[model samples]
Target: MELSWSTFLLEILNFFVLVWVLKRFLYRPIQSVIARRQQDIDARLAEASAKEAQARRLQDDYEDRLAQWRSEREQSRQALEQELRGEKARREKLLAEDLEQQRARSVAVDSRRQGEQRRQLELQAMEQGSRFAAKLLEQGAGPETEARLLSVFLESLAEMPEARRLQLCAQLRDTPKEAQLQVASAYPLDGGMRNKIEQALTACLGRPVACRFTEQPELIAGVQVSMGAWVMGVNVRDELQGFAHLAPDSVGG
Candidate 1:
């Protein structure tokens, strides 16, 4: 077939028109749809990224809270442990102090008991010793013993203070003028002894006092001169009684 230029040009123009129609109608609309889809995808990706970031932040916050809780728990545990230790220490100190006090009290009680026992033993010893001495003196009572005691008694009266002697003299003088002074002895006194004793009594009284002699075995080897309510004697029994009142050390001495 012979090539026709008009026909060829017409065909080319139809092809261009078809291309233009496709670009304006189908291609443009498809491109717009694709752009919208791309925009949607981009928006979805950005939202996913934001969500992931938020989740990470939440996870970080949760981890921080757990760590803080653990720290607080540890601190509380330490505080409780410290309190228990302090309480234990305080209780131990109190117990120790109480024990010491109890020990001190026990020591004091024991000391006091020991002291009382010692005092009792000393007193018992002193009493026994005094009794033994008195018994010996009583067993040895005789005329010679009575004479010696009488002499000692007279010497003791002579050595008495001037005021005390005068007071005794006055007291004896106040008795009834007819009242006889009695001289008692544990042993029999001979006439010579009686005369000597009478002379001594008269000298002591500063007057001739009425006198009588009597044997009283209870005198325990001593002479007793009695005038009215007054009586003076020196004997083993009186010495033993006086010794009973002495301190243990003095008795031992």
Candidate 2:
């Protein structure tokens, strides 16, 4: 290639002009588009970070609400258990009191019934005793038995009062006027029962009394004085008969 000063100058000027045109028209517009794109990318990243923070806050809130509900449910369960236990204890106490009252009532009823039974038995025994007493009084005296007759009469005479006995003696004195009657015999007339009877008759009659020496085996063992229409005899047989009528339970175990 041949080097010429004018042709080299003209080539250098054309190269400079082409670089300025590219910078002003094509390179500047391209650089502006790239910068705008980078700004958009940064805005998108900031929006993503905000959304993540909001989601975390919502999750925390849900967890707190669930914990509170669980706490309330446990407290309610414990309260219900306590109420049921109290009710059961009260029921048991009531049942025990009822049973004790029933037991006391039963004991009282049994005791009253036993007392009634004992009283009934005693009444029946008393009725039987009265009937026996009437029967013994009906059987009268037998004759020819002096010792037994006197014993029977003496036992019957002892039952009367002293005033009533004097009245009977006065009646006897007026009735039998020479009847030579014996009056009251002395108690426990030991060995001289016959002599005592004769003396009493002598005094009541106002005359001498002849004593009879007759033994009456029919009479059980007592003095009997008889002077015409008036006779009194005490007999041991009547005593034995009265005792026989008593109930076995009254005398035995």
Question: For each candidate, what TM-score against the reference?
Answer: 0.59, 0.38
**Candidate 2, overall lDDT?**
0.59
Residue 164's lDDT in candidate 2 = 66
Which candidate gets the maximum lDDT versus the true structure? 1
lDDT of 2 at 52: 79
- Residue runs of model 1 more than 4 Å from their true location after superposition: 140-239, 245-253
Compose the digit string of candidate 1's lDDT tens values, residues 89-190. 999999999999999999999988987788788889888887787788778777788778888987876677888879988887667667788888887878
Q: Highest TM-score among the candidates is held by which one?
A: 1
Q: All models: lDDT?
A: 0.84, 0.59
lDDT of 1: 0.84
What is candidate 2's TM-score against the reference?
0.38
State how far residue 80 of model 2 sits from its true place (Å). 1.4
